[model samples]
Target: MKKILILFLSIVIFSCKKEEKGFSDYLRSLDTLVLPQKFSLNSTMNSSNKYDSILFKKYKHRWTYAPYGIAFNNERIVGIIEYSIADNGLAPFLITFDNNGNKIDSLNILGNSSFGMKGQTLESAILDTNLKLVVIDSSKSWQVDIDANKIPNTTKLRVSTTIYKIQKNGKIKKIK
Candidate 1:
């Protein structure tokens, strides 16, 4: 009986000791990350800041607009800009500039409903290993219902995602 008690207590103490390091401790143990070199813009950039904001058409409706993402290839920098039109969720556009910051082309991606449905929103975008652009467009709808405990619970939350690929010639292709 004494040996069994000692073994059980030892096992409990050992188990507790094994969990000494948690997520926070693990994070502290990692070395600081080194970031890549910053991009330098020339006189052609127009604005002195590294990031330039281009405004869209203004309206009295409840709407929001922002510069979403930016990526650079061998010779050009690409920016994804988004705007909201009240009942319509998000509309995104792509603009390209040369290395010297001169405007190369500006393409509106929402006119024909090719990127997503008429009212869906664009969430984010990033450049892939091949320098091709990968974009995420999403829409979400939710419903609440009463549970057995008389509490309102989210019974359904529908989320849809779309991935697009941007080619070198400034064409948008839905790949997923």
Candidate 2:
């Protein structure tokens, strides 16, 4: 009788245990992302609902999150997530994880700004085979001197570039 009771309790306990997903599971769930890809504010990419659910549950943020791509090397897994809120354009982020599913670091791949008549900023990013991310930002701003026709004058233009490299240990380092 004691053996039967113990067996019943064991069965109940084991049956109620939930399965936890690890980083590899999440990585496997994503489609392989081709390298030498480009991303911009207007770029469109397909996403997985399951991956999005996992990301959202793990890291809660007010902005809507979409998984863009996945890539891995010998030491780490890199995932790109695009997040956006109302009025703000889409932005890409690079998140790195260790072999055991631990998050090592995250970086926003582009600069965020509001574009308008007075000033406008355009940003784009390119990921290469060497795990280098190059971001280019072009901005134009003009003095608000309205002419007789109520048109703003163009005064200045600025362009900047930033480079980032993914280290073997899953750390994102800004190289330039």
Candidate 3:
């Protein structure tokens, strides 16, 4: 009779232990999950300094959603040109897309008059304000200042950001 009671108590304790588990434990039981790609690189630079910008998806000029180079103005994509000026010199590039995947708009980001980037430098790039653009070199960060027309009777805030380059080895090093 004692054995039977002890076994019953152990089973009850084990059952209660399962009930004590929390949400985190329940989540851990899930299998490895993967997320789909929302966006992708539309195009890359033709040379080191000279880049050609192109949007991945196609969309007409949209007023509702603002579109930037190689990014979605809306659910669709629009093309753009990119240029970078660093201590190394200047890189002027034009990247555009064809009716399909073909690349067009061949313009060196930094003009030929200037020295371009050394190697694969631009890991990522972004444009701020209406005219100003920014590029993150392997060693340093650069900000492009552009003057543009703002909203009616409103003060404009100038924003700046710093970007780093990811090495081929998957390591990030700050550009000068």
Candidate 4:
């Protein structure tokens, strides 16, 4: 009985130490991440679930997080993390963290949706070197004539653009 208890305690202690080291190593790796001038969220890209426990603490069990890219300024670390709920498509978010790996703020980068009978909307974002983010949203809706066997009558397409700035202090500000 004594030997069995000792073995179990040893395993638990070693596992805890490994988890602590993994978290710090992960944060250091973020500093070396290379980001492109224009990046679109790719759902097929490989993802790490190591930080899911830390980052998605309050999220539902069906949600998953994937780190897209990371940028470093003098004061903060900006990272793009993609989230997916269940089997739904991925959505990217720009999350800011302090130097010690504490989350400061976050903003959704893009979200696309399709309305079966009403309309559909698509969104995308581009991040420039100066920490400027531009989000473009395009939507389309059509009028359906129920009397005509639900045939489409008229369609309207709308496009809009919004801009945001990620400041050095880990804050996201909407500039447009």
Best by TM-score: 2
lDDT of 2: 0.69
What TM-score do all the candidates reach, one by one? 0.33, 0.81, 0.21, 0.67
lDDT of 1 at 155: 31
Preferred candidate (lDDT higher): 3 or 4: 4
Name the runs in model 4 displaced over 4 angstroms. Answer: 1-19, 29-33, 37-44, 48-63, 85-88, 112-114, 147-153
Best-to-worst order by lDDT is: 2, 4, 1, 3
Candidate 3 lDDT by residue in tens digits, 17-98: 8444432232232222112111113332232121111221222222111112231111222233333433443343433333
> Candidate 1: where is the Cα deviation over 4 Å?
1-70, 75-93, 97-122, 132-140, 143-151
- Top candidate, metric lDDT: 2
Q: After superposing candidate 3 on the true structure, give the runs of residues whose Cα lies further than 4 Å from its correct spot.
A: 19-159, 164-176
Report lDDT per candidate: 0.38, 0.69, 0.31, 0.60
Query: Over all chains combined, what TM-score does candidate 3 have?
Result: 0.21
Tens-place lDDT digits, model 1, residues 32-82: 211221111110111112222222222101233443334334433433333
Task: Give the clashing pairs for model 4.
Answer: none
lDDT of 4 by residue, 1-176 (tens): 99999999999998888433433455543423344444334444445434444544432123335554455445446454545532235666667766666677777666554444667677767777778888888888876676533345677889999898888777889989
Displacement of residue 139 (Cα, Å) in model 1 is: 4.6
Better of 2 and 4 by TM-score: 2
> What is the lDDT, from 0 to 100, of the residue 127 in candidate 1?
44
Which of 1 and 4 is ahead in TM-score? 4
